[model samples]
Target: MKFSVFQLSRRGARARNEDRIGYCYTREACLLVLADGMGGHAAGDVAAQIALNSVCALFQARATPLLDDAPGFLAEALLHAHRQILRHAQQHHLADAPRTTLVVALLQQGQAWWIHCGDSRLYLARAGALLARTRDHSFRAMAERSGQPPASVNRNLLFTCLGSPSLPISDQAGPWPLARGDRLLLCSDGLWDALGETELLALLAHDPVSLCVPRLVDRALQHTGASSDNVSAIALEWEMPGAQSAPDSISTDALEGDAFESTLQLDAPDLPEPAPPVPALPEDELSEAAIERTIAEINAAIRRPGERRR
Candidate 1:
């Protein structure tokens, strides 16, 4: 199988774009990684960079071409990234460590295996429909899933992430067989949270992987407007040249429990929770336009001369 890939990021009226994205591949295996820095904390970009770099380093050191155990590599790599964040915090004497949400996907031997910490997401689209996606590890999401009281809560309060004093917990999924035209999208909340699931599926289904990603980011930025956080995404298509079209999208019946693989948590001393819930993005940083008004401005900005250069 051959793969086509594209990635993009924009500051989107924020002071600094803290989101990061990249991928690594060998002849027989490939890995895709994405992260969203926790903006309420100090040096969030630092945490994001460290997290990506640490994982890449491990990938480089391992046996290339093919992994003996893709899931095991992913789990251990994420844990190592957690430790690197802790070490950075100690070295800098940060009162609160920089934190980030991460998602990683490994493709090898005709199947895909993946893991995520916090809310960054990975979505798989096949044959014009949504096949699977990650569920956020946030308090509000947990509450919604549980069908319990207090459903209205801050969706930004994540229960797990790298660089917190507490041990990080990550959920893993997949080993799902890939179809020739299967499309994978890995993105920060800035991208997925801003767009509806149906809209996203449409883009993935119809547009070429290269074009769909940039348009998605552009729409997301306009949808969120000035209040938009850093927007970023990776779009990948597994194209089996000269092959017949893929089968229909995964069925709801057969998809049951197939999307979630497992979870891993390392041993670490418990840390006290912060008094104030952390902001997914700083309130003060991107204040020019709230998401509601962004579309009009985006259109106007596009119509003006030389405005697109900015």
Candidate 2:
């Protein structure tokens, strides 16, 4: 497993940066994550950090070289992160939970899988053009897609995010085969909001991530000047085995089966908590309505594969 990767974050005009980005890898899998803390909420930075920590911890535990169910793992990890954020709010007795946008990309088995909630995004590019990217869970994006006037919609107004009261609605895509020069980028809204897609593509297509990422952040800061939001991005260029590695390239060939590597910084709040048990169902459990109700209940109750009910 070899790839060139780069990540950058800037405070811009904000008092403090609430955005977070990081990556981790095992011999057969890589996990890239980005989270943008919503400035309107309290403890936004904490929410962003919790999101990264929960997801990376799960990756370290499950990616014993590679995940057996990439898509399923993506979904579960996202939900787990959301729950962790809620737990933080509960523990702190906050009036409202801190909120954040999240995006994650998992590279393994010669393909890629991704998931996102809210405005943070993942872009997959090959041969210059943008091949794919996640859709933002904001009214602005939905309005544009529905052919409505997006100008009237507030771009920062997102309808879903981690740490919200309800289950966050997220999108997932994957198993897309990797090409030798394929590029994947995970970023906060701050970066994309300041720069156009054309500018982003040009930079990504022409240089390695280590080069493009810094340039991208610089240009975004220039575009918004003193009022720029917190800009952050992490990107990587996929390379086939035995390919010439970039200056900042990583090779996991020497790692043992149980070894794990990561750039994410984990702290006390990042620790995993035991999931609550699902209450036993009554006699009508087989009813269709009951089944619909229990789906969410079961998801909330089960944390990991084969976790014992307590």
Candidate 3:
């Protein structure tokens, strides 16, 4: 099997880029991760970076090359990341406890396994329709399931996430069998909240990550305007054996099975163009006091009822 992956991050309209980090790695198979930090100031950034780094490092160290135990490996990686985030927060006297949303995808032996926490999502598409997705661990999901009014379930507030020692760390995974011409997308809420499955499938229909990712980002930004949150996207396309005879190859659309059809589309808006970059603060410019203030605000917001709505 052959795969392609790409990642990009921008600060959005915020004064600082709290959005954190994203990564895509394929050894025997593929591992894609997106982490959105949730502390104040750059603490969110720190928390996100820590969680992602820890996850990748643990996966590399513990997971076997062929990934026979991919699910266990992913779960352990998430647990390690959670611990690392807690350690970092304790080491520093940051006022707010840091947290993050994590989404991971691993492809092995023609099968895919994914796990996630919070709102970042994983979507699988085949022949221009969504096959499956990971549901968000947010208040909105609960309210929707409970038959509350759609308007009552605010999308911003999370019910559970990584980093908090109080909440049970979520460890969820499932297998996704793959075939030729299947597409997988892993992204942060910033991107999916604006764009729907149809738009994503259409953008990825005939392109590689190099072309499709930017278009997805550009479209999300265009639709959301400057107020949009930080945007990150990773697209994976499966190529069958003997399908890459030429520099550019387009394969015939063969159905994997009748498990999914080609008519499903998510009812969401298009994305907008990306905003200008936020100036990065100098190393010395990030003072401990400033970090503390940010952490405090972040903690207060997390404790409140609506901080997650944004």
Model 1 regions lying over 4 Å from their true place: 149-151, 241-310
TM-scores for all candidates: the values are 0.77, 0.85, 0.75
Candidate 1's residue-wise lDDT over 1-310, tens digit each?
3677767777777888787776655456667888788998998887886777666545544523467888898998898778878877999888988999999998877788899999999999898688889989999889988886645778889999999989888999889899887989999888888999988788777756778888998899889997987888887787563454334211112222212111111111111111111111122332223321322332233234431110
Judge candidate 2 against the unseen true structure and give its global Cα lDDT, from 0 to 1: 0.81
Q: Which ranges of candidate 3 are over 4 A from the true structure?
A: 20-27, 39-42, 168-171, 245-310
lDDT (0-100) at residue 240 of candidate 3?
69
In candidate 3, what are the lDDT values of residues 1-310, reduced to their tens digit? 4655555555555555555443323234556677877643346766676666565544433333356588887887777678777777778966656888888787767789988888888888887778888888888888888898758667878877788767534646567788777888877788888887677678867666668777888888888997888777767787765666324332223422111111000111321221111122233444434433433433343234421110
The candidate 1 region of ten consecutive residues with least summed lDDT is: 260-269
Model 3 residue 77 lDDT score: 70
After superposition on all CA atoms, how large is the RMSD of candidate 3? 12.7
**Model-by-model lDDT, in order?**
0.70, 0.81, 0.62
